[model samples]
Target: MTRLRMGMIGGGPGAFIGPVHRFAAELDREIELVAGVFSSDPGRSKAAAGAYRIDPARAYGSLAEMFTTERARADGIDFVAVVTPNHNHLPSARAALQAGLPVICDKPLTATLDEAHALAAVVRESGLPFAVTHTYSGYPLVREARARVAAGAVGTVRKVVVEYPQGWLAGEASGKQAEWRVDPARSGLGGCIGDIGVHAFQLAEFITGLEVTELLADLGAVVPGRALDDDCTVLLRFANGARGVLLASQIEVGELNGLRIRLYGDRGGLLWRQEQPNTLTLHTLDGRTEIVHAGGPQLGPDALSRTRTPTGHPEGYLEAFANLYRDFAAVLRGEQAPLLPGIGTGLRGMAFIATAVEASRAKAGWVKLSV
Candidate 1:
C-alpha cells in the first residue's frame, strides 16, 4: 500500500496539539508528513518543517502557497490536517477542499456558526471526505459503549451526564493554548463550551445516537479578568425524549482532563471515563454491575477493530486518536472505513456552541438548536 502524503496547517513551535496530531497520524504508519505551513512566521514554519523532517522545498510560508505548490506536485499531499486555532479552521479547510484535498480537522468545526455553515456548504459542493476529530469517539471502549446502546443492551437511553473539567485555567492562563482559548477573537463566542464542552456534548450524542433538540446553558468566567467563560453547565433535551446534563469547566480546582460520561437507560446504565479509558462499567436494573475491559472477548467488531493492545496492556489517548487517522487513511485509499464524525458533526458542534452562548446570555433559558 502506498503511504498517503499528509500536510498540515498551523501547529508551530509552542503549539500543544500539533505534536499530538503528528504522533497519532504516524502511529499507524499509513500516512506521512510531507509538507506544512506551520506558522505565519516563515522562519518558524521552516523550523517546524525541519523538525518533522519535511523537505525544505515543500515547506511553504502560507496555506495558499502550500496548497498551490503541493497540488502541482506528482506526489502532492493526499490530505490536509487543519490543526490551527478555531478562527483559522474555516479558511484553511476551505482552501484545502477547493484544492481538491480531503480534510481531517480538530473539533468544534470553526470559530462560529456562520463559518461552519459556509464551510459545510463548500464541503457539500466539493464532495470530499471531511472528518472532525472528536477524539473520545475513537476509543475502543467508547465504541463498545455506543454499540451496546445501539444494540438495545441498555434499552432506550433516558438520561446522560457528561463532564470535562480541568484546573489549568482555575486561576489565570498564560500559555499559547490557554491564551487563544480565552480570547473571543480567536476562540469565538463560546469559550469553555467551545473548548472542552463540545467534547462532552459530542460524546453524549455520539454514544447514545441521540440529537440534542434543545439546551439551556449557564456559563461563567470563574477567574477574574478572563474575557470568556472558564466554566459552563448545560441542560440538554434529546430528540428521543431523553434529558441530559453537561458540565465543562477549566476552573475546577483539582481536575485534569477529567472527562466522564454516564448514560442511563430503562434497563441499565453505562459509564466511561477518559482518564480510565481502558474499562467501561455497566449497571443493570437488577443491581448487577459489570466491568468490560478493552481488548476483551465480549466487545463487538467495531470495538475490536479499534483495539490494538492485549486485554491488559492498555490503549490510551494517542492510540484512540490514531484510530481516526487509520480509518481516514483507509477511506482515502478507497477502502471501507468505520463510521467517523463528519461535516454534519462539525455543523452540529458549532450550532451547539452558538446556541449555548446565546442561551447563557439570555439568562440560561432553554434554546432550540438550529442545526
Candidate 2:
C-alpha cells in the first residue's frame, strides 16, 4: 500500500509534542511526513522543515497558508496532524477538514466545549475520518481491558479508579511546558484536568465503554500564584449506575508519569498499571486470580491486531501512540478499519473538562456531563 502523505502544524523548534508526533506517525511505515508548517515564525518554520527534511515549498508560515497551497496541489497532504497548542487546534483542523483532507489531532480537542462541538459538527457534516490521539487507548493491555469488559469477563462494572500524577511541576514552574500550560490563552479553562486528567477521564470511559453522567470535582492550585488548578479529584457517576473516582495532578512530589486504573464489577475486577503496561491483573469473585500478559495466546483480537513483536518484547507509550497513527492512516486509505476515536471522543474530553470545572466551582454538589 502507498504511504499516506501527512503534514504537521505547530511542532517546530523546542516543541515537546511535535517530535513525539513525528516519531509515532513514522514508526509503523504506513504514513509519511511529506510537509509541515513547523512553527509560528517563518525562519523557524523553514528551519524546522529543514530539520525534518521536509520540502521547502510545502513549509509555510501559518496553517492557513499550508491549507491554501495544499488545496491547490494535486499531490497535497492526505491528512494533517495538528500538534499546536490548545488554541490553534480548531482553526488548523477546520481548514484541513474543509479542504477535503482527513485530520488527526492531539487532545483536548479545543480550548472550549463550544469549539469542540463545532469541530465535531464539521466532521459529521463532511463525513471525514478525524482521529484524536488519546494515545492510551492504543495500548495493547488497554485494548485487552476493553475486550474483557465487552465480553462480559468483568461482568457488570460497579466502580472505577483512575489516577495520573506527575511531579514535573513539583516546585516553582519553569521551562516551555509549564509556561504555556499555565497560561489560560494557551491551555484551556481547566489546568490539570485539561492536561493529563483528560487522559485519565478518557481511559476510564474508553475501557469501560461507559459515559460519565455526573461528576463532582475538587480542584486545587497547590502552587501559590498559579492561575489554573494544578491538581484535581473527581467523583464520577456513570450512566449504568456505576461510580468512579479520578485523580490528576502535576505537583505530586517524587512521582513521574504515574497512571493506573482499577475497575471492579460484580463478578470480577481488573487492574492495569501504566508503568508495567505489559500485564493486566484480574481477580474473580470466586477466589480465582489471574495475570494476563501481552502477546499471550489468550490475548483478544484487539490486542493481537496491533502487536508487532512476540512475547517479552517491551512496548510502551510510543508504540501505543504509533498504533493510533497506523490505524488512522489505514482508514484514510479507504480501507475497512476498526472504529477509531475521532471528534466525538474529543468532544467527550472537552465535556469532561467543562464538567470538572463546573463541579469544582459548584457548592460541593454533583454536576452532570452536559454532552
Candidate 3:
C-alpha cells in the first residue's frame, strides 16, 4: 500500500505537540508529512519546511493556499492534521473537510461547544474519516483494559476514579504552551478540564463503556487570579447508576503528567496508570490479583495488534500516539477500527466541558450531561 500523504497545520519552530504529531504519524511509515503550513509567518513556515526537509514549494503560507494547491496536485496530501491551538481547530478542520479531505485533529474539538458543532457538521457533510487524538486510548494496556471491561472480566462496573495532575502551571507561566492554555479565547473555559481533564473524562467512559449521565462540578483556578479553572473536581453519575470522581489539576506541586484510572466492578477492579503504561492490574473479589503486561499472550486481539514489540520493550506516549495514526491509516484504507475515537468523541468531550463549566459557574447541585 502507498503511504498516505499528510499536510499539517501548526507545529512551528517552538511548538511542542506539532513535532510530536509529526513523529507519531511518521513512526509507522504508513503516513508521511508531505506538506504543511507550519506557522502564521510565511518565512517561518518555509524555515520549518526546510528544517523538516520537505519540499519548499509545499510549505504554504496559509490554509487556503495549501488546500487549493495540494488539491490540484496529482499527489496531494491524503489528509490534514490539525495540531493547532483549540481556537484554530474548527477553522482548519472545517476548511479541510469542506475541501473533501479527511482530518485528524487535536483534542477538545474546538474552543467552544458551538464551534465543535459547526465543525462536526462539516465533517459529517464531507463524509470523510475524522479522528481526534485522544492519545491515551491508543495504548496497548488501555485497550486491554477496555476489552476486559467489555468481556465482563471484571464484571459490572460500579465506580470509577480518574485523575490527571501536572505541576507545570503551579506558578506564573508565560511559555508558548501555557499562554494559549491560560487564555479563555484560545483554550476555552474550564482550563484544567478542557486541557487534560477531558482526557480523564474520555478515558473513564472509553474503558467502562458507560456514558456520563449527570455531573456536579467544582472548578476554579487555584493560582491567585487566573481567569479559567486550573483545578477541577467533578462528581459523575454513569448511565448504569455507577458513581465516578474525576480530578484534574495543574497546580499540584510536584506531579507531572500523572493520569491514572481505577474502575471497580461487582466482581473485581481494574487499574492502569499513564506513568506505567506497560502493565495493567486486575484484582478479583476473592483477592486474587493479576498482572497483564503489554505484549503478553493474555492481552486481547486489539491490544496485541497495537503492541509493536516483545513483552519487555516498554512503549510510552509516542508509541501509543502512533497507534492512533496507524489505525487512522487503516481507516483511510477502508478498514474498520472500532477502537478509534472519532468526531463523536470530540462532540461528547465538548459537551462535557460546557456542562462542567456551566455547573461550576451556576453552583448547580446536579446537572444532566447533555451532548
Residue pairs with backbone atoms closer than 3 Å in model 3 (clashes):
none
Better of 2 and 3 by TM-score: 3
Candidate 1 clashes between residue pairs 3 or more apart in a chain or in different chains: none
Q: What is the Cα-based TM-score of model 2?
A: 0.97
Return the TM-score for each candidate structure.
0.98, 0.97, 0.99
* Candidate 3: tens digits of C-alpha lDDT, residues 1-371: 69999999999888999889999999999999999999989998998987777999999999999999998999999999999989999988998888888999999899999998898888888899999999999999999999899999889999999999999999997899998899989888669999999999999999999999999999988888799999999999999999999999999999999999999999999899999999999999999999999999888899999999999999999999999999999999999998899999999999999999999999998999987
The C-alpha lDDT values of all candidates are 0.92, 0.89, 0.94
Candidate 1 wrongly placed segments (more than 4 Å) = none
- Candidate 3, backbone clash total: 0
lDDT of 3 at 53: 79
User: Over all chains combined, what TM-score does candidate 3 have?
Assistant: 0.99
lDDT of 1 at 170: 86
**lDDT of candidate 2 over 1-371, digit per residue (tens):** 67778899888888889889888999988888988988889888988877788888888987778888887888888889999989888988898888888899999999889899989998898899999999999999999999899888889999999999998987888988788888889897878899999999999999999999999899988899998889999999998999999999999999888999999999999999888999999999999999998888899998998877888898999999998998898787777656477788899999989888877877558887977
Q: What TM-score does candidate 1 reach?
A: 0.98
Model 3: which ten-residue window has the lowest total lDDT? 183-192
Q: Highest lDDT: give the candidate number.
A: 3
Candidates in descending lDDT order: 3, 1, 2
